[model samples]
Target: MIFYFSGTGNSAWVARQLAEGQNEELLSIAVEIDKNKEYKLREGEKVGFVFPVYAWGPPEIVLRFIRRLKMIKPEYLFFVCTCGDDTGRTAQLFSSAVARKGWRCAAGYSVTMPNTYVSLPGFDVDDEDVETQKVHNAVARVRFINEEIVSRVQTKHYNCHEGALPFTKSYFLRPFFNTFLMSPKPFHATEACIACKKCEKACPVNNIKVTDRPVWGDNCTQCLACYHICPVHAVEYGKVTAKKGQYKGRLLRDL
Candidate 1:
């Protein structure tokens, strides 16, 4: 089973591609976790994960979900990360986490995507040309990644780089971040808001609650899924973010 956790559509899109390309069944970790209250992988199935890289590491939710999961060792396991640049040292951290779980990793690869988080409006407003370049790059890398996946399935040997250090300021740290998240902050609508409410519904973490005014929840992973998938381009982090803008790592959409 291939499980994915995406804040933006990038990880989900990648997961979809991997599943279709490899002919593997696809599952959303958030959906299963939410409905079942717990999720476990079937034994003997090849397992994999695709997600965005945050602070040079995996998303907080991914860490929480993986830690809480119960699973038997798959014949092969792999992880793919989409980032705006090189993965830095976070790959090592991920490898260690899996090692502790006693599951061998098959391969870890990084792809580039447009950095949408920090790009500012009037500063780096979405550049189609740059985005196109990133998409092309990802397509090129995916071909090689497909080959690696095939080899790993055959050999059952893979090594992943450790990811970045977790931002552990203690339990209080999460609550602190939540304050900004749950408040009337960040999101700004473009002229494009069709009010479809897809953003509110798409939030797996329940970060966006559709009240009279959409309310953000405390527990958030900043996966950017809501932001990227918004059809209207109606979301913005803040004026500061509008200036700095957001960015994803190296991988762009494959097709």
Candidate 2:
């Protein structure tokens, strides 16, 4: 089974392409988290995970779901992570995380997709031209990865884009980002909100509730689904995202 967790459609698009190319079953990790069902991979079936890189590392939701899932180590296990620029030792961290669960990631790949992180200073969504080019490149990258996985290529690191200072970014800065920045407290709808419940419905983890306005819960994974899915330019992360562009968050409809 190919499991995926996406916030703004980048990883979702990659996962869909891979599943179709490899003829693998696609499953949503977020949806499966609440289930009591048990899963065991057949002898020949391979396992794959597709998710976005968050704070230069794998998202907390992915690691959490990995711990929750029950499965026999497949003949080939792999992961694909989407990122705006580069992943800093994310592959290393992801491989170690899965190793702790008695599963080995036979290979890992990173694809540069459309940028969606705009909550911080000097960081915003990519322009139309850059975004389009990244999407175009990602399609080709995923195609190559699909063929590699289908061939059961067991390279520990396959086509990973790990930029400079991998250890510092993954180990040092990632912890700080997860601790201080990954929170829902700064999220609130401005006066432009129309009381539309789209944010509540778009949240992969059900961390949003809409009454007169949307209220965020503490269970959030900081995926920014609500901020991106708002039809109006109402959702803001404090004052930072007020002037930032919005991502379409296309795959939220499937959640």
Candidate 3:
């Protein structure tokens, strides 16, 4: 089984491509979390985990879900992380986590995708030309990875960079950001909101509630799904995001 956790559809697109190429089953970690289900890999089936990198590490929800996952002795295990730029020690962190769960991570890879973390300064969604190029490159990478996995390659790591800054940022800055910066207090819906509840349903954590307007709760992963998925461009993350462009990766319907 190939499990994926996506915010704005980048990782979802990668997971779908990999699954299709390998003829493996694709599962959504968010939907599984919402349903409160425990997953176990079938005997002899290889397992794959795909997700976006957050703050140089895996998202908290992915970690939580992995902790709760129960897997039988699988033939192999691999992970693919999608990032806007470089993946700093994310592969190492994921391998460590899976190791703690008594599973040996056979391989780890990263694919560069369009930047989607617009809540912070110096970060914005890529322009159409750049985004298209990134998607094209990602498709080729996923195709190559599928071939490697099908060959049962024992490669341990791929496309990861580890250094002092990456280590410090992931270990120190990540905790600070996850604790203090990831909250729903900054989100607000404007008059453009149609009360479609797209933001509410798109929220992987169910941190949004739609009445006359969308209300944000304390739980937020800073995934930016609400902001990117809003059809009417109604969601805003403080004044900082007022003029920033929103982005949601093309859905399967669009494909």
Candidate 4:
């Protein structure tokens, strides 16, 4: 079974590709394994995880899900993280967690995507082909995952993307970041918006509610789901971000 948690469809996109290529069952960590839920794993089943990288590590939701997960003893396990840049040492976080659960991590990888956490305005990745290349490369990475799983190679250590280190203390600096990043105040629809409601469906966490005016809740993780998925190029993070280049949720076929 392939388990996935995605906020901006990056992780989910990769997970679906891997499952399709490997002919595996897909499971959503967001809905299937909630705060209180049990997992059903058959003997000799292979388990995999695909999630987004956040703050140089796993997202808060991924960590919380891992903590609450009742994992079965799978014969194989793997992980893939969709990140904007090099996620140095962030992959190690998962290795440690799975170890604590008495589950061996077979293999892991990180793929790049557009950095959507708009609260961190400075962390922008403007490469036009970044998302497309990420999708293509992730498809190839599945081959490596399958090989490692077949070998039963347990990974105790994972590598980090170069220079992708944690800057400030998340506990202390996160509040300031979240205050501005997680709120609905920053996102405003322009006249270009048609109220298409694509943003509402794209929200993995269901943080966005579209009505006469869009509303966001404090539960947002700044994943930029709404901004990227907006079909009309209507959603934006304010004047500063609009100048930097607003995200309009471009896909491969959309090109």
Residue by residue across 130-222, what tens digits does model 3's lDDT show? 988888887788888888888877874565544458878888888888887787798999899999999999998788999999999987888
Highest-lDDT candidate: 2
* All candidates: CA RMSD (Å): 5.2, 2.3, 2.0, 3.3
Best by TM-score: 2
Name the regions of candidate 1 deviating beyond 4 angstroms. 35-44, 119-126, 153-195, 229-234, 243-254
Could you give candidate 4's per-residue lDDT for residues 1-255 as a string of tens digits?
A: 888988766677778777875667998876875558677877777788888876666776777778788867677888888776766556667877888888777778776656665545575645667756764665566566555555656766553353523444233444454454556677787888787888888777777788865777766666777877776667887764564555444563342
Evaluate residue 88 in candidate 1 and report its C-alpha lDDT on the 0 to 100 scale. Answer: 51
Model 2 agreement with the true structure over 175-220: per-residue lDDT tens digits = 9999999888999999999998999998999988899999998998
Candidate 1 clash figure, as a count: 49
lDDT for model 3, please. 0.84
- Ranked candidates (lDDT, high to low): 2, 3, 4, 1
What's each prediction's TM-score?
Answer: 0.74, 0.95, 0.93, 0.81
Off by over 4 Å in 3: 34-40, 161-164, 251-255
RMSD versus native structure for model 3? 2.0
Question: How many clashing residue pairs are found in candidate 4?
Answer: 3
Please give the ranking of all candidate structures by TM-score, highest first, separated by commas.
Answer: 2, 3, 4, 1
Model 2: lDDT to the true structure: 0.87
Compared with the true structure, the alpha-carbon lDDT of candidate 1 equals 0.63
